[model samples]
Target: MAATIDELIALVEQNRDAVVGDLFPVREAAPRLIEASVYHPVICLILQGSKETTSHAGSVRLGRGDMLVVSHDTPVTARITGVPYLALILPIDLERVRTLEQSLTSADAGQAASVLQATVAGSAILETLARLLAIRPKTPEDSVLTPLLLTELHFHLLRSPAGAMLRRLVSPSSHESRIARVAALIRRDYARVHRLADLAREAGMGQSAFHHHFKAVTGTTPLQFQKDIRLSEALRLLEQGAVSVTEAGLSVGYESPAQFSRDFSRRFGRPPRRVLQGIAAE
Candidate 1:
Protein backbone atom coordinates (compact mmCIF):
# COMPACT_ATOMS: atom_id res chain seq x y z
CA MET A 1 0.00 0.00 0.00
CA ALA A 2 1.09 3.52 -0.70
CA ALA A 3 2.08 5.65 2.27
CA THR A 4 -0.84 7.58 3.75
CA ILE A 5 0.41 11.05 2.88
CA ASP A 6 1.69 9.92 -0.52
CA GLU A 7 -1.68 8.51 -1.52
CA LEU A 8 -3.50 11.62 -0.35
CA ILE A 9 -1.11 13.91 -2.20
CA ALA A 10 -1.55 11.87 -5.39
CA LEU A 11 -5.33 12.08 -5.07
CA VAL A 12 -5.23 15.84 -4.57
CA GLU A 13 -2.79 16.29 -7.42
CA GLN A 14 -5.16 14.44 -9.72
CA ASN A 15 -8.29 16.35 -8.66
CA ARG A 16 -7.75 19.22 -6.30
CA ASP A 17 -11.43 19.77 -5.73
CA ALA A 18 -12.64 16.22 -6.03
CA VAL A 19 -15.21 14.81 -3.62
CA VAL A 20 -14.35 11.15 -3.36
CA GLY A 21 -17.45 9.05 -2.67
CA ASP A 22 -19.24 11.78 -0.69
CA LEU A 23 -17.28 10.73 2.37
CA PHE A 24 -14.21 12.90 2.01
CA PRO A 25 -12.70 15.63 -0.17
CA VAL A 26 -9.13 15.98 -1.39
CA ARG A 27 -8.15 19.62 -1.52
CA GLU A 28 -4.94 20.83 -3.18
CA ALA A 29 -4.43 24.54 -3.33
CA ALA A 30 -2.06 27.43 -2.81
CA PRO A 31 -1.99 29.59 0.27
CA ARG A 32 -5.09 31.76 0.46
CA LEU A 33 -7.75 33.08 2.79
CA ILE A 34 -11.04 31.25 3.13
CA GLU A 35 -14.09 33.25 4.11
CA ALA A 36 -16.13 32.50 7.17
CA SER A 37 -18.78 29.81 6.79
CA VAL A 38 -20.59 27.14 8.76
CA TYR A 39 -18.58 23.92 8.84
CA HIS A 40 -20.41 20.71 9.59
CA PRO A 41 -19.01 17.94 11.77
CA VAL A 42 -15.85 16.54 10.19
CA ILE A 43 -12.35 15.33 10.87
CA CYS A 44 -9.54 17.06 9.00
CA LEU A 45 -6.15 15.44 8.61
CA ILE A 46 -3.44 17.58 7.13
CA LEU A 47 -1.11 15.55 4.95
CA GLN A 48 0.94 18.44 3.66
CA GLY A 49 1.54 22.03 4.72
CA SER A 50 -0.65 23.81 7.29
CA LYS A 51 -3.78 25.85 7.90
CA GLU A 52 -5.49 27.87 10.61
CA THR A 53 -9.13 27.97 11.74
CA THR A 54 -10.40 31.03 13.62
CA SER A 55 -13.68 31.15 15.48
CA HIS A 56 -15.05 32.67 18.66
CA ALA A 57 -13.38 29.79 20.47
CA GLY A 58 -9.98 31.02 19.22
CA SER A 59 -7.51 30.31 16.44
CA VAL A 60 -5.90 26.90 15.97
CA ARG A 61 -3.08 25.98 13.58
CA LEU A 62 -2.74 22.42 12.32
CA GLY A 63 -0.03 20.86 10.22
CA ARG A 64 1.29 17.51 9.08
CA GLY A 65 0.73 14.55 11.41
CA ASP A 66 -2.03 16.41 13.24
CA MET A 67 -5.77 15.78 13.33
CA LEU A 68 -8.66 18.18 13.95
CA VAL A 69 -12.10 17.07 15.02
CA VAL A 70 -14.93 19.57 14.67
CA SER A 71 -17.97 18.35 16.60
CA HIS A 72 -20.65 20.81 15.53
CA ASP A 73 -21.62 23.22 12.81
CA THR A 74 -19.49 26.27 13.40
CA PRO A 75 -18.95 29.52 11.54
CA VAL A 76 -15.27 30.29 11.22
CA THR A 77 -12.51 31.72 9.05
CA ALA A 78 -9.83 29.40 7.67
CA ARG A 79 -6.58 30.01 5.83
CA ILE A 80 -4.35 27.64 3.91
CA THR A 81 -0.70 28.46 4.40
CA GLY A 82 1.19 25.90 2.36
CA VAL A 83 2.77 26.15 -1.07
CA PRO A 84 0.35 23.54 -2.29
CA TYR A 85 -1.80 22.69 0.65
CA LEU A 86 -3.17 19.17 0.63
CA ALA A 87 -5.74 18.06 3.16
CA LEU A 88 -8.16 15.19 3.60
CA ILE A 89 -11.64 15.98 4.95
CA LEU A 90 -13.84 13.20 6.31
CA PRO A 91 -17.42 14.20 7.12
CA ILE A 92 -18.57 12.58 10.33
CA ASP A 93 -21.70 10.48 10.10
CA LEU A 94 -23.49 11.31 13.33
CA GLU A 95 -25.97 8.48 12.95
CA ARG A 96 -23.22 5.96 12.55
CA VAL A 97 -21.41 7.44 15.52
CA ARG A 98 -24.58 7.31 17.58
CA THR A 99 -24.91 3.64 16.81
CA LEU A 100 -21.32 3.05 17.80
CA GLU A 101 -21.81 5.01 21.01
CA GLN A 102 -23.82 2.11 22.37
CA SER A 103 -20.71 -0.06 22.38
CA LEU A 104 -18.66 2.40 24.35
CA THR A 105 -18.26 1.77 28.07
CA SER A 106 -18.47 4.36 30.82
CA ALA A 107 -14.71 4.57 30.67
CA ASP A 108 -15.11 6.15 27.23
CA ALA A 109 -16.86 9.20 28.53
CA GLY A 110 -13.96 11.64 28.25
CA GLN A 111 -13.83 15.36 28.81
CA ALA A 112 -15.59 17.26 26.08
CA ALA A 113 -14.62 20.48 24.39
CA SER A 114 -16.34 21.97 21.40
CA VAL A 115 -14.64 23.61 18.41
CA LEU A 116 -11.74 22.60 16.20
CA GLN A 117 -8.99 20.94 18.20
CA ALA A 118 -5.58 19.53 17.43
CA THR A 119 -4.80 15.98 18.55
CA VAL A 120 -2.42 13.21 17.68
CA ALA A 121 -3.84 10.26 15.81
CA GLY A 122 -2.80 6.77 16.84
CA SER A 123 -1.04 4.25 14.57
CA ALA A 124 -4.20 2.21 14.25
CA ILE A 125 -5.99 5.19 12.76
CA LEU A 126 -3.14 5.76 10.36
CA GLU A 127 -3.01 2.11 9.35
CA THR A 128 -6.73 2.02 8.71
CA LEU A 129 -6.48 5.16 6.63
CA ALA A 130 -3.67 3.68 4.63
CA ARG A 131 -5.70 0.56 3.94
CA LEU A 132 -8.67 2.73 2.94
CA LEU A 133 -6.59 4.80 0.52
CA ALA A 134 -5.12 1.71 -1.11
CA ILE A 135 -8.45 0.29 -2.18
CA ARG A 136 -8.98 0.09 -5.98
CA PRO A 137 -12.54 -0.78 -6.88
CA LYS A 138 -12.89 -2.50 -10.22
CA THR A 139 -16.17 -4.33 -9.68
CA PRO A 140 -19.61 -3.89 -8.11
CA GLU A 141 -18.56 -6.00 -5.14
CA ASP A 142 -15.68 -3.63 -4.64
CA SER A 143 -18.14 -0.77 -4.07
CA VAL A 144 -19.37 -2.34 -0.86
CA LEU A 145 -15.79 -2.53 0.32
CA THR A 146 -15.50 1.24 0.64
CA PRO A 147 -18.41 1.54 3.04
CA LEU A 148 -16.99 -1.23 5.18
CA LEU A 149 -13.66 0.53 5.27
CA LEU A 150 -15.40 3.77 6.14
CA THR A 151 -17.10 2.04 9.02
CA GLU A 152 -13.76 0.72 10.13
CA LEU A 153 -12.35 4.21 9.84
CA HIS A 154 -15.06 5.51 12.13
CA PHE A 155 -14.30 2.73 14.52
CA HIS A 156 -10.67 3.72 14.69
CA LEU A 157 -11.65 7.32 15.38
CA LEU A 158 -13.92 6.16 18.19
CA ARG A 159 -10.96 4.47 19.88
CA SER A 160 -8.35 7.10 19.20
CA PRO A 161 -7.12 9.60 21.78
CA ALA A 162 -9.92 11.95 20.84
CA GLY A 163 -12.47 9.18 21.02
CA ALA A 164 -13.93 10.30 24.32
CA MET A 165 -14.58 13.78 23.02
CA LEU A 166 -16.11 12.26 19.90
CA ARG A 167 -18.21 9.93 22.02
CA ARG A 168 -19.68 12.85 23.91
CA LEU A 169 -20.42 14.54 20.61
CA VAL A 170 -22.56 11.65 19.37
CA SER A 171 -24.26 10.52 22.57
CA PRO A 172 -28.00 11.24 22.28
CA SER A 173 -28.43 12.47 25.81
CA SER A 174 -25.30 14.58 26.12
CA HIS A 175 -25.48 18.37 26.19
CA GLU A 176 -23.24 18.50 23.12
CA SER A 177 -25.62 16.31 21.20
CA ARG A 178 -28.56 18.51 22.23
CA ILE A 179 -26.75 21.62 21.04
CA ALA A 180 -25.70 19.90 17.84
CA ARG A 181 -29.32 19.03 17.10
CA VAL A 182 -30.24 22.67 17.49
CA ALA A 183 -27.42 23.66 15.16
CA ALA A 184 -28.62 21.14 12.61
CA LEU A 185 -32.07 22.69 12.85
CA ILE A 186 -30.66 26.11 12.11
CA ARG A 187 -28.74 24.77 9.14
CA ARG A 188 -31.84 23.13 7.74
CA ASP A 189 -34.15 26.11 8.35
CA TYR A 190 -31.91 29.16 8.20
CA ALA A 191 -34.16 30.79 5.62
CA ARG A 192 -37.07 30.68 8.07
CA VAL A 193 -37.59 32.75 11.18
CA HIS A 194 -36.30 31.03 14.34
CA ARG A 195 -36.99 32.07 17.91
CA LEU A 196 -34.51 31.34 20.68
CA ALA A 197 -37.29 29.98 22.88
CA ASP A 198 -38.37 27.56 20.18
CA LEU A 199 -34.83 26.39 19.58
CA ALA A 200 -34.27 25.94 23.34
CA ARG A 201 -37.37 23.82 23.55
CA GLU A 202 -36.14 21.74 20.66
CA ALA A 203 -32.96 21.10 22.61
CA GLY A 204 -34.93 20.19 25.71
CA MET A 205 -33.38 22.98 27.74
CA GLY A 206 -34.60 26.19 29.29
CA GLN A 207 -33.78 29.44 27.51
CA SER A 208 -30.85 30.40 29.76
CA ALA A 209 -29.26 26.95 29.75
CA PHE A 210 -29.82 26.56 26.04
CA HIS A 211 -28.10 29.83 25.32
CA HIS A 212 -25.14 28.90 27.48
CA HIS A 213 -24.70 25.42 26.04
CA PHE A 214 -25.31 26.60 22.50
CA LYS A 215 -22.46 29.06 22.81
CA ALA A 216 -20.33 26.51 24.60
CA VAL A 217 -20.84 23.97 21.86
CA THR A 218 -20.74 26.23 18.83
CA GLY A 219 -18.91 29.30 20.11
CA THR A 220 -21.76 31.51 18.90
CA THR A 221 -25.27 32.39 20.03
CA PRO A 222 -28.29 30.77 18.44
CA LEU A 223 -29.28 33.92 16.54
CA GLN A 224 -25.78 34.47 15.22
CA PHE A 225 -25.68 30.86 14.10
CA GLN A 226 -28.82 31.35 12.03
CA LYS A 227 -27.53 34.61 10.63
CA ASP A 228 -24.27 32.98 9.63
CA ILE A 229 -26.08 30.21 7.82
CA ARG A 230 -28.29 32.71 6.00
CA LEU A 231 -25.48 34.99 4.99
CA SER A 232 -23.36 32.06 3.89
CA GLU A 233 -26.17 30.84 1.67
CA ALA A 234 -26.71 34.32 0.32
CA LEU A 235 -23.03 34.62 -0.55
CA ARG A 236 -23.11 31.26 -2.30
CA LEU A 237 -26.15 32.26 -4.34
CA LEU A 238 -24.58 35.57 -5.31
CA GLU A 239 -21.33 33.87 -6.29
CA GLN A 240 -23.11 31.41 -8.51
CA GLY A 241 -25.03 34.22 -10.24
CA ALA A 242 -28.16 32.33 -9.34
CA VAL A 243 -29.89 35.42 -8.02
CA SER A 244 -29.64 39.20 -7.79
CA VAL A 245 -28.27 40.76 -4.63
CA THR A 246 -31.69 41.67 -3.31
CA GLU A 247 -33.10 38.32 -4.32
CA ALA A 248 -30.27 36.49 -2.65
CA GLY A 249 -30.72 38.47 0.52
CA LEU A 250 -34.49 38.09 0.58
CA SER A 251 -34.24 34.43 -0.26
CA VAL A 252 -32.19 33.82 2.88
CA GLY A 253 -34.72 35.33 5.32
CA TYR A 254 -33.66 38.91 4.90
CA GLU A 255 -36.71 41.17 4.71
CA SER A 256 -34.96 44.53 4.58
CA PRO A 257 -32.49 45.11 1.76
CA ALA A 258 -30.60 47.69 3.78
CA GLN A 259 -30.08 45.38 6.72
CA PHE A 260 -28.98 42.57 4.41
CA SER A 261 -26.46 44.76 2.69
CA ARG A 262 -24.97 45.93 5.97
CA ASP A 263 -24.72 42.42 7.40
CA PHE A 264 -23.32 41.00 4.18
CA SER A 265 -20.70 43.71 4.03
CA ARG A 266 -19.71 43.19 7.65
CA ARG A 267 -19.33 39.43 7.30
CA PHE A 268 -17.64 39.20 3.90
CA GLY A 269 -15.70 42.48 4.06
CA ARG A 270 -17.36 43.50 0.78
CA PRO A 271 -20.83 44.46 -0.33
CA PRO A 272 -22.83 42.14 -2.50
CA ARG A 273 -22.90 44.57 -5.42
CA ARG A 274 -19.13 44.98 -5.44
CA VAL A 275 -18.55 41.26 -5.14
CA LEU A 276 -20.86 40.68 -8.06
CA GLN A 277 -19.06 43.34 -10.06
CA GLY A 278 -15.74 41.62 -9.42
CA ILE A 279 -17.17 38.27 -10.43
CA ALA A 280 -18.52 39.76 -13.64
CA ALA A 281 -15.18 41.34 -14.40
CA GLU A 282 -13.51 37.97 -14.03
Candidate 2:
Protein backbone atom coordinates (compact mmCIF):
# COMPACT_ATOMS: atom_id res chain seq x y z
CA MET A 1 0.00 0.00 0.00
CA ALA A 2 2.82 2.40 0.87
CA ALA A 3 4.54 1.63 -2.43
CA THR A 4 1.31 2.34 -4.36
CA ILE A 5 0.82 5.69 -2.58
CA ASP A 6 4.44 6.61 -3.20
CA GLU A 7 3.95 6.01 -6.91
CA LEU A 8 0.71 7.98 -6.80
CA ILE A 9 2.43 10.92 -5.12
CA ALA A 10 5.02 10.97 -7.90
CA LEU A 11 2.30 10.82 -10.54
CA VAL A 12 0.37 13.59 -8.83
CA GLU A 13 3.49 15.74 -8.70
CA GLN A 14 4.14 15.13 -12.38
CA ASN A 15 0.54 15.63 -13.55
CA ARG A 16 -0.17 18.60 -11.34
CA ASP A 17 -2.33 20.26 -14.00
CA ALA A 18 -4.85 17.36 -13.82
CA VAL A 19 -5.73 17.72 -17.51
CA VAL A 20 -8.57 15.25 -16.93
CA GLY A 21 -10.27 18.19 -15.16
CA ASP A 22 -12.37 16.22 -12.60
CA LEU A 23 -9.32 14.82 -10.82
CA PHE A 24 -7.65 17.42 -8.61
CA PRO A 25 -4.54 17.03 -6.48
CA VAL A 26 -4.06 19.00 -3.27
CA ARG A 27 -0.59 19.29 -1.76
CA GLU A 28 0.58 21.47 1.09
CA ALA A 29 4.09 21.50 2.44
CA ALA A 30 3.11 23.17 5.69
CA PRO A 31 0.17 23.06 8.04
CA ARG A 32 -2.50 25.67 7.26
CA LEU A 33 -6.09 26.50 7.88
CA ILE A 34 -8.61 26.42 5.05
CA GLU A 35 -11.28 29.06 5.34
CA ALA A 36 -14.91 28.11 5.70
CA SER A 37 -16.85 27.31 2.56
CA VAL A 38 -19.98 25.54 1.43
CA TYR A 39 -18.58 22.16 0.41
CA HIS A 40 -20.47 20.24 -2.23
CA PRO A 41 -20.56 16.47 -2.55
CA VAL A 42 -17.08 15.07 -3.17
CA ILE A 43 -14.58 12.39 -2.21
CA CYS A 44 -11.23 13.33 -0.70
CA LEU A 45 -8.50 10.69 -0.52
CA ILE A 46 -5.78 11.47 1.94
CA LEU A 47 -2.50 9.96 0.75
CA GLN A 48 -0.04 11.61 3.12
CA GLY A 49 -0.12 13.49 6.43
CA SER A 50 -3.43 14.40 8.06
CA LYS A 51 -6.18 16.99 8.23
CA GLU A 52 -8.83 17.94 10.73
CA THR A 53 -12.14 19.05 9.22
CA THR A 54 -14.89 20.70 11.21
CA SER A 55 -18.48 21.20 10.16
CA HIS A 56 -21.75 21.74 11.99
CA ALA A 57 -22.03 17.99 12.35
CA GLY A 58 -18.74 18.09 14.26
CA SER A 59 -15.09 17.37 13.47
CA VAL A 60 -13.20 14.45 12.04
CA ARG A 61 -9.48 13.80 11.69
CA LEU A 62 -8.26 12.04 8.58
CA GLY A 63 -4.84 10.57 7.97
CA ARG A 64 -3.29 8.53 5.20
CA GLY A 65 -5.83 6.29 3.41
CA ASP A 66 -8.77 8.09 4.95
CA MET A 67 -11.54 8.82 2.51
CA LEU A 68 -13.85 11.68 3.31
CA VAL A 69 -17.13 11.24 1.48
CA VAL A 70 -19.31 14.27 1.72
CA SER A 71 -22.85 13.56 0.52
CA HIS A 72 -24.42 16.98 0.98
CA ASP A 73 -23.57 20.65 0.82
CA THR A 74 -21.94 21.65 4.10
CA PRO A 75 -20.22 24.63 5.67
CA VAL A 76 -16.74 23.43 6.57
CA THR A 77 -13.45 24.59 8.05
CA ALA A 78 -10.37 22.44 7.66
CA ARG A 79 -6.81 22.47 8.92
CA ILE A 80 -4.03 20.44 7.44
CA THR A 81 -2.65 18.68 10.49
CA GLY A 82 0.53 16.88 9.42
CA VAL A 83 3.39 18.28 7.40
CA PRO A 84 3.57 17.73 3.66
CA TYR A 85 -0.12 17.03 3.33
CA LEU A 86 -1.15 15.47 0.07
CA ALA A 87 -4.58 14.41 -1.16
CA LEU A 88 -6.85 13.92 -4.14
CA ILE A 89 -10.21 15.66 -4.36
CA LEU A 90 -12.77 14.16 -6.66
CA PRO A 91 -16.02 16.10 -6.93
CA ILE A 92 -18.87 13.67 -7.33
CA ASP A 93 -21.44 14.25 -10.06
CA LEU A 94 -24.88 13.44 -8.64
CA GLU A 95 -26.23 13.26 -12.16
CA ARG A 96 -23.83 10.44 -12.87
CA VAL A 97 -24.59 8.86 -9.48
CA ARG A 98 -28.27 8.96 -10.31
CA THR A 99 -27.63 7.32 -13.63
CA LEU A 100 -25.55 4.67 -11.88
CA GLU A 101 -28.19 4.17 -9.20
CA GLN A 102 -30.66 3.08 -11.87
CA SER A 103 -28.50 0.06 -12.56
CA LEU A 104 -28.29 -1.28 -8.99
CA THR A 105 -29.80 -4.72 -8.58
CA SER A 106 -32.28 -5.64 -5.85
CA ALA A 107 -29.54 -7.23 -3.78
CA ASP A 108 -27.53 -4.03 -4.01
CA ALA A 109 -30.51 -1.78 -3.34
CA GLY A 110 -30.75 -2.37 0.40
CA GLN A 111 -28.17 0.14 1.58
CA ALA A 112 -28.44 1.14 5.23
CA ALA A 113 -28.80 4.77 6.29
CA SER A 114 -25.57 6.49 7.31
CA VAL A 115 -25.05 10.00 8.60
CA LEU A 116 -21.27 9.80 8.54
CA GLN A 117 -19.37 11.92 6.03
CA ALA A 118 -15.98 10.24 6.44
CA THR A 119 -14.64 6.72 6.55
CA VAL A 120 -11.50 4.63 6.28
CA ALA A 121 -10.88 3.87 2.64
CA GLY A 122 -10.63 0.25 1.57
CA SER A 123 -7.81 -1.29 -0.49
CA ALA A 124 -10.07 -1.43 -3.54
CA ILE A 125 -10.59 2.32 -3.42
CA LEU A 126 -6.87 2.94 -3.12
CA GLU A 127 -6.10 0.72 -6.08
CA THR A 128 -8.76 2.40 -8.19
CA LEU A 129 -7.43 5.85 -7.31
CA ALA A 130 -3.95 4.79 -8.33
CA ARG A 131 -5.30 3.69 -11.72
CA LEU A 132 -7.12 7.02 -12.13
CA LEU A 133 -3.93 8.96 -11.41
CA ALA A 134 -2.07 6.83 -13.94
CA ILE A 135 -4.18 8.10 -16.88
CA ARG A 136 -2.57 10.89 -18.92
CA PRO A 137 -5.30 13.28 -19.85
CA LYS A 138 -5.80 15.23 -23.14
CA THR A 139 -4.44 12.34 -25.16
CA PRO A 140 -6.45 9.96 -27.35
CA GLU A 141 -6.12 7.33 -24.65
CA ASP A 142 -7.45 9.83 -22.10
CA SER A 143 -10.49 10.48 -24.28
CA VAL A 144 -11.46 6.83 -24.13
CA LEU A 145 -10.03 5.86 -20.75
CA THR A 146 -11.09 8.65 -18.36
CA PRO A 147 -14.79 8.00 -18.71
CA LEU A 148 -14.46 4.27 -18.12
CA LEU A 149 -12.21 4.78 -15.12
CA LEU A 150 -14.52 7.40 -13.63
CA THR A 151 -17.47 5.04 -14.02
CA GLU A 152 -15.50 2.30 -12.38
CA LEU A 153 -14.47 4.60 -9.55
CA HIS A 154 -17.98 5.81 -8.91
CA PHE A 155 -19.26 2.25 -8.99
CA HIS A 156 -16.65 1.22 -6.47
CA LEU A 157 -17.66 4.15 -4.26
CA LEU A 158 -21.32 3.11 -4.51
CA ARG A 159 -20.42 -0.31 -3.17
CA SER A 160 -17.88 0.89 -0.61
CA PRO A 161 -18.86 1.15 3.06
CA ALA A 162 -19.70 4.83 2.63
CA GLY A 163 -21.95 3.89 -0.25
CA ALA A 164 -25.00 4.21 1.99
CA MET A 165 -24.52 7.95 2.34
CA LEU A 166 -24.22 8.38 -1.41
CA ARG A 167 -27.16 6.11 -2.06
CA ARG A 168 -29.43 7.92 0.41
CA LEU A 169 -28.64 11.28 -1.10
CA VAL A 170 -29.35 10.03 -4.61
CA SER A 171 -32.42 7.96 -3.87
CA PRO A 172 -35.39 9.82 -5.35
CA SER A 173 -37.77 9.16 -2.43
CA SER A 174 -35.33 9.70 0.41
CA HIS A 175 -35.72 12.81 2.55
CA GLU A 176 -32.00 13.47 2.21
CA SER A 177 -32.35 13.50 -1.55
CA ARG A 178 -35.34 15.85 -1.34
CA ILE A 179 -33.48 18.25 0.94
CA ALA A 180 -30.49 18.11 -1.39
CA ARG A 181 -32.71 19.41 -4.19
CA VAL A 182 -33.77 22.42 -2.11
CA ALA A 183 -30.17 23.04 -1.09
CA ALA A 184 -29.11 23.04 -4.75
CA LEU A 185 -31.70 25.71 -5.46
CA ILE A 186 -30.40 27.87 -2.63
CA ARG A 187 -26.82 27.47 -3.87
CA ARG A 188 -27.80 28.60 -7.40
CA ASP A 189 -30.05 31.54 -6.47
CA TYR A 190 -28.33 32.51 -3.24
CA ALA A 191 -28.32 36.17 -4.16
CA ARG A 192 -32.08 36.19 -4.70
CA VAL A 193 -34.86 36.35 -2.15
CA HIS A 194 -36.19 33.00 -0.98
CA ARG A 195 -39.16 31.96 1.10
CA LEU A 196 -39.11 29.04 3.51
CA ALA A 197 -42.62 28.04 2.46
CA ASP A 198 -41.62 27.77 -1.18
CA LEU A 199 -38.48 25.88 -0.33
CA ALA A 200 -40.51 23.45 1.76
CA ARG A 201 -42.90 22.86 -1.10
CA GLU A 202 -40.01 22.28 -3.44
CA ALA A 203 -38.74 19.56 -1.14
CA GLY A 204 -42.25 18.07 -1.09
CA MET A 205 -42.43 18.36 2.68
CA GLY A 206 -44.45 20.50 5.05
CA GLN A 207 -42.67 23.55 6.44
CA SER A 208 -41.90 21.94 9.80
CA ALA A 209 -40.85 18.62 8.29
CA PHE A 210 -38.73 20.33 5.68
CA HIS A 211 -37.07 22.46 8.28
CA HIS A 212 -36.26 19.46 10.46
CA HIS A 213 -35.01 17.29 7.64
CA PHE A 214 -33.06 20.06 6.00
CA LYS A 215 -31.21 20.72 9.20
CA ALA A 216 -30.72 16.99 9.70
CA VAL A 217 -29.15 16.55 6.30
CA THR A 218 -27.16 19.78 6.05
CA GLY A 219 -26.40 20.43 9.74
CA THR A 220 -27.71 24.00 9.32
CA THR A 221 -31.02 25.72 8.74
CA PRO A 222 -32.07 26.82 5.27
CA LEU A 223 -31.82 30.53 6.11
CA GLN A 224 -28.46 30.01 7.78
CA PHE A 225 -27.32 27.94 4.83
CA GLN A 226 -28.11 30.85 2.54
CA LYS A 227 -26.30 33.19 4.90
CA ASP A 228 -23.20 30.98 4.88
CA ILE A 229 -23.26 30.80 1.10
CA ARG A 230 -23.62 34.58 0.85
CA LEU A 231 -20.80 35.23 3.30
CA SER A 232 -18.51 32.69 1.61
CA GLU A 233 -18.97 34.45 -1.71
CA ALA A 234 -18.38 37.86 -0.18
CA LEU A 235 -15.19 36.58 1.43
CA ARG A 236 -13.95 35.25 -1.92
CA LEU A 237 -14.61 38.57 -3.62
CA LEU A 238 -12.90 40.47 -0.83
CA GLU A 239 -9.92 38.14 -0.99
CA GLN A 240 -9.60 38.79 -4.72
CA GLY A 241 -9.50 42.58 -4.11
CA ALA A 242 -12.33 42.84 -6.55
CA VAL A 243 -14.76 44.78 -4.35
CA SER A 244 -14.95 47.05 -1.33
CA VAL A 245 -16.47 45.79 1.91
CA THR A 246 -19.87 47.34 1.17
CA GLU A 247 -19.89 46.20 -2.43
CA ALA A 248 -18.90 42.67 -1.44
CA GLY A 249 -21.84 42.53 0.94
CA LEU A 250 -24.32 43.99 -1.55
CA SER A 251 -23.07 41.79 -4.37
CA VAL A 252 -23.80 38.68 -2.35
CA GLY A 253 -27.43 39.68 -1.61
CA TYR A 254 -27.01 41.51 1.68
CA GLU A 255 -29.21 44.61 1.60
CA SER A 256 -27.56 46.14 4.66
CA PRO A 257 -23.81 46.62 4.85
CA ALA A 258 -23.83 46.58 8.65
CA GLN A 259 -25.60 43.22 8.69
CA PHE A 260 -23.12 41.79 6.25
CA SER A 261 -20.19 43.04 8.26
CA ARG A 262 -21.60 41.59 11.46
CA ASP A 263 -22.22 38.23 9.82
CA PHE A 264 -18.78 38.23 8.26
CA SER A 265 -17.10 39.05 11.53
CA ARG A 266 -19.11 36.43 13.38
CA ARG A 267 -18.36 33.66 10.91
CA PHE A 268 -14.77 34.50 9.96
CA GLY A 269 -13.60 36.06 13.26
CA ARG A 270 -12.67 39.21 11.34
CA PRO A 271 -14.39 41.98 9.42
CA PRO A 272 -14.42 42.13 5.63
CA ARG A 273 -12.10 45.11 5.85
CA ARG A 274 -9.37 42.91 7.33
CA VAL A 275 -9.43 40.68 4.27
CA LEU A 276 -9.16 43.77 2.05
CA GLN A 277 -6.28 45.20 4.10
CA GLY A 278 -4.44 41.91 3.97
CA ILE A 279 -4.89 41.70 0.21
CA ALA A 280 -3.63 45.24 -0.23
CA ALA A 281 -0.61 44.57 2.00
CA GLU A 282 0.23 41.61 -0.18
**Alpha carbon deviation, residue 167, candidate 1 (Å):** 0.9
Model 1 agreement with the true structure over 13-80: per-residue lDDT tens digits: 55545444454554556788877467888888888888888877678888886788877777778888
How far is each candidate from the true structure, as Cα RMSD in Å? Answer: 2.6, 2.2
Per TM-score, the best of the predicted structures is: 2
The TM-scores, one per candidate, come to 0.89, 0.92
Give me candidate 2's TM-score against the actual structure.
0.92
Q: Give the local distance difference test score of model 2.
A: 0.82
Give the Å shift of residue 185 in candidate 1: 0.4
RMSD of 1: 2.6
lDDT of 1 at 30: 72
The deviation in Å at residue 75 for candidate 2 is 2.2
Q: How far out, in Å, is residue 74 in model 2?
A: 2.3
